[model samples]
Target: MMNSREIIAKRVAKFFKAGDLVNLGIGMPTIVANYLPAEAKVMLHSENGFIGLGPTPAEGEEEKDVVNAGAAPVTIVPGGACFDSAMSFALIRGGHLAATVLGALEVDEKGNLANWMVPGKMVPGMGGAMDLVAGARKVIIAMEHTTKEGNPKILKSCSLPLTAANEVDYIVTELGVMEITPEGIALRELASGVTLEEIQAKTEANLIIPDKIDIME
Candidate 1:
């Protein structure tokens, strides 16, 4: 059985094309940087002001000054440039990013994303998430199927503050891959050991399953 992290990584890697300028958010989204094909020309963008990102480095290779949004030490690729956080945001806001992979708290059927803050829960600031979702050409969310207590994270509507309303394009979970559309979520793939009925039972959002389901595993 594939663990949640591996499942999310595999799904996220499928969306990339060569030469894409991608922004990887704090958590699971950062794993995709390590899994992409070596020959693929995907340039990573760090919201803190760096381009030409690379995978997490070895223990001895860690650079204290180089980090992803998650604050994890990461290796910088050749020709990488670091600048001010403000300028980095300008790049995102200017639509310089091709895509951004973000982690979400909840995702609606209409592709609305809520990842900023959990209402009533003490947490850090929302950070640069708002800019990433708004400026990227495509927004992909990486998360698990349910919360720690076994409740769904994908829902008909979000319970937390929204990062972007109707802006998400794709969602990848341990259970499957869903494409967001104007009508609702389109079921694109189901993981091994998962059935459409089971997925529907576990999900809170309205799902549009195809006549034939694609097994994502």
Candidate 2:
């Protein structure tokens, strides 16, 4: 059976296409870069001002200025280009990005995202998520099925602060892949070892399981 990280990687890989421009958010979202198809050329856009990005830099070889939007150090591809942060947002806000993979705290039935601050806990600022959700052609969220204590992240309504409304199109969890529609999360696919009833039982929100189940093997 695939672990949580591997499951996220597999789900991300399925979304790849040739000549697509994509942005990967912090943490699990950043892992998508390592799984992208080698044969298919996908241009990676970093909100910190680099396009055509590569993987994370080696240990002890970190560059202070060369980092991702999350401030984590990164390595660039041979043909990579760097620009100002303002100019980078221009590309994202101008709708040049085809898709974005973001990590979220909570995703409601209406496809709203809440990833920024956790209120009293003082989490990371909203950052570029606002623009990414509103501008990207498609926004996919890559996260675990539940919280550290096993509470579901997919909910009927988000408890944390929202980043955007009705923005998320797809969501990948260890349990399954849920396609967010105007009404709610449509159960389009499930992991190879998981079942629709199992996922629904684990999830805290109402799930719309489609008649046809696309099992991701």
Candidate 3:
């Protein structure tokens, strides 16, 4: 059985297709790159200023300068390019990306996201999350099902400051995959060995579970 993080990453990776320009946000979202199918031919964008980002480099093979937006050493695929922040924001704000996978602290039934800062904790700033969620053609959230204290991160309404209003399209977690729709949050698939009752207990939002829910691959 795969661990929780790997389960989420593997499930989230299925959303991308060939030729898609995707931005994998820091944290859990970055793991999606490792699970992407080799033939997908997806191009990764880093907000700090690079594209064609590859998976994490082996420990001994780390490049001194090549890194993702998270400042973690990474590999650049062949034909990848590096540029200034101006160009990076231009590409993002221009809505050229097919999708952007991000991690979130809270996601409400209305698809509102709040992930940047937790009130008392000092943070550098909101970073590119604001632009990424609003600018990306599709915003996919990759995060755990619950907080460390066993609190539901998916709620009927977000308590934290929102990163974007009604912008999230999909939410992928260790327990299941959910899609925000006009009606509400739809439970599309459940991870193997997890039950509907288990998911509902961990989710504060009312899930629209279909009769024929599929198991996550």
Candidate 4:
């Protein structure tokens, strides 16, 4: 069985298609880079100003100032280009991205995203998520099933500050892949060994399991 991070990354990778201009958010969502299918060619855009991102740099060989939005060193593929933050955001706000993968703290049934801050917590501010969620052609969230304290991240409503409203197109977690629909959170696919009952037990919101199950192997 795949580990949690690997499970989430692999599942998220399934959404990528040919000719996609994608942006991967910081933290766990960044791993999606390593799992993208070889047949599906994608151009990775970093809000920090680089496009056509490659793999993360090896340890002890880190180069200065070559990084993703998280400031971690990353390799640049051929044809990659860098621009000022203004131009980078222009590309984002202009709706040129085919899909953007983000890591969220909470995503409600209404598809609202709350990923920027946690009230008293010292978060680094709401970076470019507000723009990405609102302008990307498709917004996909990659996150863990629950918080460290076991609180479900998927809910009927978000309690924390919101980054965008009704913007999530897909959600990939360790347990499954979900579609945020008007009716509710739809369990479009489940992990090989995960069950609807198990997902229901852990989820706080109403889950819509389709009549047909697409069990991911």
**Most accurate candidate by lDDT:** 3
What is the TM-score of each predicted model, taking all chains together? 0.93, 0.92, 0.94, 0.94
lDDT of 2 by residue, 132-174 (tens): 9988999999998888998889999998889999889998887
lDDT (10s digit) by residue, model 4, range 18-95: 888999888888888888877788899999997888887789877888887777788898879999999998899898
The C-alpha stretches of model 4 lying farther than 4 A from their native spots are 58-62
lDDT of each: 0.86, 0.85, 0.91, 0.87
Clashing pairs in 3: none
Q: Pairing residues by index, what is the TM-score of model 2?
A: 0.92
> In candidate 1, what are the lDDT values of residues 95-142, reduced to their tens digit?
888899998889999788988787678567778888888889999999
Which stretches in model 2 have alpha-carbon errors above 4 Å?
A: 57-64
The C-alpha RMSD of each candidate to the native structure, in angstroms, is: 1.6, 1.7, 1.5, 1.6
Clashes of 3: 0
Q: Sorted on lDDT, highest at the top, how do the candidates line up?
A: 3, 4, 1, 2
Which parts of model 3 have CA positions greater than 4 angstroms off? 57-62
**What TM-score does structure 3 among the candidates reach?**
0.94
Q: What's the lDDT of the predicted structure labeled candidate 3? A: 0.91
Model 3 lDDT per residue over 124-157, tens place: 5789999999999999999989999999999999
